[model samples]
Target chain A: MSKHLKHLLTYVVALLLFVFMGYPFLYMISTSFKSLESFFIEPFAILSWPLNFSNYTEVFTMGLGRYFMNSIIISVTAVTLVVLVAALASYPISRLKFKMNRPLFLLFIAGMMLPIHATLIPIFVLTQNLGIYDSLLALLGPYIAFALPISIFILTQFMQEVPKELEEAAMIDGCGHIRIFWNIMVPMTIPAISTIVIYNFIHIWTEFIFALVLISSPGNMTLPLGLQRFYDEFSVNVPALMAALTLASMPILLVYIFAQEKVVKGLAGGAVKG
Target chain B: MQTVSPVKTSKHLEIKKKKKKWKHTFTICMFIAPALFIYGLYVLYPILSTFQLSLSSWDGNPAGPTFIGLDNYIRLLSDPIFFKALRNNILVVLTSVFIQIPLGLILALLLFAPLKGLRVFSTVYFMPFLMSTVAIGLLWIFIFDPINGPLNKFIQTLGMKPVAWLGSPDTAMFSVLLVIVWQFAPFYMILFKAAMVGIPDELYESASIDGATGVKKFIYITLPLLIPTMVTSSILAIVGSLKQFDLFYIMTGGGPSNATELMGTYMYKNAFLSFNMGYASTIAFTMFLIAFIVTVIIQVLEYYRRKKGVFS
Candidate 1:
């Protein structure tokens, strides 16, 4: 084939792929800007004139803000805890020579394939017994627990690559394991740490089933649960629901837009390493 | 006198070595304790609890469980819905591995083509994956809306009747399967893209010198190199398919006469909606077992394949 023909073919295929992957999102954002009458009249139109901004303002009033805040608080807290604990555990697992090192690493790695459903009922019961059900606190345990396997996996993989000499030199300076981990290992593993943070943050931010099971109150619900509630309460008012979705998805989108390379790498890093 | 001095020094060094080893073990324990405790409580213990619960009947009440000794499993063998759900779960696994992975590879290859506006094309292609499953489910619900959705409107434009995409049993699974492909194909795209970048440019250069065409080079070189990634992607898709809940739960709730019932959705309904926690545990444990068995089988196969030097 001629080079020009090949180029044209590439563009054609790219456009079709774009529509398949992206058109739904476009329709969503477009519909969010349509009034009910306009939506009913020209629901399939890519864009409607006399754009409606009411849906955007209305979703916030319907407690999207509360869900947003709850999600941020929970995700930040859980990601922080996961990073710290996973990193601490990764140091010994990756660097130290314990009898259980290989077995322990495999044990944690096995959690990646384990279904959350298996543990769902017991977790629900445990949360209730702890008197923390229906609140943000109920989510923390599972979020951190679920995030650990991958976090430890990624951190240990990266830690294994860090030169042993750096930590050994620190030890020679009379620095204890804690001191070396804090000063040497943590600094060296910042790239991996950031990947874990982004990966877990996205997972926790949009985590659904756990929130659906544990959290009941609107005020305590995360973004995914809150979005589900919006769907239930306002099934007829799709414009408003789309607006809520657009808002709920904004933070991740914006993060991706700004840090495209890092976001892609971070999201793919865990699976790619395997 | 010399022998006695040497023995004393050696004995002292042995005692010191034992003390150092004890301290090293203590430090390792301290580091591992927090993660192990949380992982054990929430993950390890819950898995055992699910297995134990699967043996009995319970209503998720304070009255406690009654040990029925695998009655739930016995009932599961006869339940039509459970069988339907298991079959649907397998459908999801097949769709993910067969359709989604190939589609993802196509998109990833498109991104590497020498085309203008590459950034725009790549960005839009990845947009579906960045949205939360809840958001994606809700968005697609509107898109598949029987009356006002663009899909039916487009169908009407084609001079055909508007179909109830999600409302009909025949189409619900297909509709959701399309959405799953859309949501996850980008993930595999990035995975393939990362792997593709690791393929050395020198190999392609050598192929060019050998008078190799694009397709030939891809077949002989690129495809062979991507086998590891393909294996990893298949494993992820299969395990992921078994555990998928949010999309199906939000989209159809496994309805339209159970046409789209997956094990995850079925288990959710049993536990929360119907309050049959024990049967739910039974389904949930079975999902774990399937995933575990599949993972182990894949690992063993991959190990033996590597041992036999199949790919390398």
Candidate 2:
């Protein structure tokens, strides 16, 4: 094929793949605005005129808003805890000379491969025994633990690349390890830290199995769990379920759009390295 | 005016050194303690306990588990459903390795050559990976809906009979696998793309000069250079497929007569539905063992390859 033809072919192929990949999302957005009757009648239509806003409204009335809030809280808390703890743990392992640093780092790395299923029963029993069962707090411990491995792995690698001269200069000025870490290290590792924060936030936001097993009460259900329950209760209400799915996915999608570079680079970095 | 004795000065130096050493250890401990505590409690401890749980029977009650001593494993060997689930998991792994990774590599290769509007295409391809699995599962469930779903509608437009994609046992696993590939292929694409971008342009330029261009150049240059990435990514795909839960669970619930049962969903049902904690733990442990063994084999293979200077 001619060069121009090949380029055109590539674009055509890419566009076809794009359409294949994007169709569901576009269909989803359109369906959320569609009425149940229209959805049944014209399911394959790209658009439905006289869009129904009632599905969106009905989702909130059916307690999607509560689930949304619950997700936000749990995700935010988990991300914050993971980032903070991971950063703290990573600093000494990355910079300071210590006897057990390598072993400790490896310990965290080992945690990465742990199947969440293996820990599910024990975590369930532990949370119940600790009296945090059926509460949002029950999720925090596991989320932070699972989040630690990758966060620590990434942060430690990032922190190691940080110039040691800065820390040495801070030490010369009588700054302690904690002060130096807070001032020099944290600011310098912001990229990695933000990546950790975003990944953890996204992971915890959509995490379901733990939430399903741990939280019994509907009052504390996160978006994924709540959506599952909602689907079960209203299995036939396609439009409403679409609306809820869209709602559940909207924030992260928006974040991905705006912070596309950071999210992609960060995730690729973590995945490749970890 | 301030001439001190040698012993006094040496004593003062010793005290300062001791204090600094203690302070250094304290700082290290303080920095690491919180993470260690939480990780130990939630991750490490639970992992060890899972092994114990696997060897015993329990109903998840307060009465505590009783030692059954390998009964769960023995029973699992006899269980048909467990074998079915294992087959499904292996099928997922095989499909991911043979199908998803290669497709992802093709897409990545297509997009690798600098082209206009590729960024937008890349984002579109990757959007599914970022979306929640539950949402993806629900979306596919709607798409596969026999009566009102677009997939069936499209089939009907193609002059074919509309089929119940997820509702039928024969097609259910395939449908779920399709969704899995849809959501995850982009991940491997990004991974391969990253590795491909790192290949210096001069190599390709030289290859073309030698009249080894196009697929020939790719086979000789790009494919060999991408081996390490391929190894890592394939391992990722394998482990991920084995541990997959959310998509299958939400979409099919291993349903239509256990046609889509995976180790994950099987273990989940055994634990939560059947309340057979012991057997559930065995399944979970088996999952861990499989993942662990696969990972170790990959690492060992990578080690040997590196030793042979295969991709250095």
Tell me, by DockQ, which candidate is best. Answer: 1
Evaluating just chain A, the predictions reach TM-scores of 0.97, 0.96
Show the lowest summed lDDT stretch of 10 residues, model 2 chain B. B1-10
Cα lDDT tens digits, model 2, B1-312, are: 347587888799999999999899999999999999999999889888999999999998889999999899999999999999999999999999998999789779877766787778888888988889999999999899888888888889899999989999999999999998899888889899888988999998998899985889889999999988888788788877888999999999999899999999999999999999999999999988988887788779889988998876
lDDT of 2 at A175: 98
What is candidate 2's lDDT per residue for A1-274, written digit by digit as tens? 7988987887888878888789999988998899999987887777799989999999999999999989999898889888899999999999999799999999998776767999999999999899999999999999999999989999999999999899999999999999999999999999898888777888888898999899988899999999999889997888899899988899988999899877777677667642
Candidate 2: list runs displaced more than 4 Å: B1-18, B113-116
Residue B12, candidate 1: C-alpha displacement in angstroms: 4.3
Residue A209: error of model 1 in Å?
0.7
Candidate models: Cα lDDT each: 0.93, 0.89
Q: Candidates' TM-scores?
A: 0.98, 0.95
Candidate 1 global CA lDDT score: 0.93
TM-score of chain B of 2: 0.91
Error of 2 at A244 (Å): 1.2
